[model samples]
Target: MSTVFDFAANLLGGGEKPLADFSGQVLLIVNTASKCGFTPQYEGLEALYRQYGARGFSVLGFPCNQFGAQEPGDSAAIAQFCSLTYDVTFPMFAKVDVNGADAHPLFKFLKGEAKGILGTEPIKWNFTKFLVDRKGEVAGRFAPTTTPKDLEKEIEKLL
Candidate 1:
């Protein structure tokens, strides 16, 4: 009976943030990478956050270096890159592994709630997104190729 609200994550700003703090909000949880080809997706994600954030919508970014060592930066560098390059304003968590034994507990719960293509649980690459509804239930899983802009309608429905 574990919900997303049951977990907590370390923020890039250097503290633990319980998911329960975002209760009743539609969340787009994304595993991001600063050097990935899809890095630009941050801009679209920021747009989505700005467009719907006031309506109980949020984009929670988690940087992961498991793929091609694309996100090797520390919290400061990640924060700076996201700020200066993409101007991302949404909440971002400390770097974590999206796939593997050491995967963050929240991610484990998210992947368990929403499997990917062919019922796969592992995140295929960086930028893979998991959408959670207001009730902290996983709504859908989007692949790395799926752009943040592509999830607007679905997010609207949840909101």
Candidate 2:
């Protein structure tokens, strides 16, 4: 019975933000990295957000350094990079571990809800995305190779 709303994580700005704040909206939750090759996907994510934000859809970004130390920056750095580089305006959270023993509870729950290729659960790389429906149920999982723009159809279906 635990939806994403049952979890809370620190905002990139410095406070705990309940996932409940995003309840009733279809969500595309992504584990991001700054220096990774897939970093440019931020533009596509922002595009999706801008295009569908008014329709009860949102893209929540979480910076993660767990992969190749690609995101080795502090909250301020991450926030600035996102704003200045990609003009991202979506809600972003503090850095979090998306895999291993210390993975964030919300991510652990998401992984369980949407297993990856061949039923694998671990996130393979940065830019991993999980799409959630309005009811907070995880609808799909996308690998780093799956660009954000490529998910528009599925996102539309969820909306």
Candidate 3:
């Protein structure tokens, strides 16, 4: 059975990071855009990470430019923006294509695991979120309109 751990992504820093590093932890994975209206989600996401990090929960952010060209900056700039603006301390990954032919393998697997509204698999917009349980199985998919605060109960259940 293929899991998200089967794929590896580039860290915002300079190394390849395999999703396997997060094994056994509940994960809230999101495709982010710095310049989009939803960019403020970084604050809520960071709050979730800080609140639950010690309890085997993690929030992973992946910058994606596929929507509205909102994330046109390079990895370093993206990293800096998140840190300076939102004080985001969670793991941020390199820019990736969340849709289309170049979509990262991990995202493809994630979408397959949990389809979005009306069973549509394609991500509708940036800030699309996926919740993964400790066993590395996808638990649920949240739409761009779903705020991070709305996920608290579900996250608590997973923890």
Q: Candidate 3 local accuracy as lDDT?
A: 0.93
Q: How well is each residue in 1-159 modelled by candidate 2, as lDDT tens digits? A: 989888999999999999999999999999999999999999999999999999999999999999999999999999999999999999999999999999999999999999999999999999999999998999999999999989999999988
lDDT of 2 at 7: 92
What C-alpha lDDT values do all the predictions have? 0.94, 0.96, 0.93
| Colliding pairs, model 2 | none
> Which window of 10 residues has the lowest lDDT sum in candidate 2?
1-10
State which candidate, 2 or 3, has the greater lDDT.
2
Query: Who wins the lDDT comparison?
Result: 2
Off by over 4 Å in 3: none
27-146 per-residue lDDT for model 1 (tens digits):
999999999999999999999999999999999999999999999999999999999999999999999998889999899899989998899899999999999999999999999888
- TM-score for predicted model 3 compared with the true structure: 0.98
Listed in order, each prediction's TM-score against the native is 0.98, 0.98, 0.98
- Give all candidate RMSDs, comma-separated: 0.6, 0.6, 0.7
TM-score of 2: 0.98
State how far residue 124 of model 3 sits from its true place (Å). Answer: 0.7
Clash totals for all models, in order? 0, 0, 0
Per-residue lDDT, model 3, residue 83, is 88
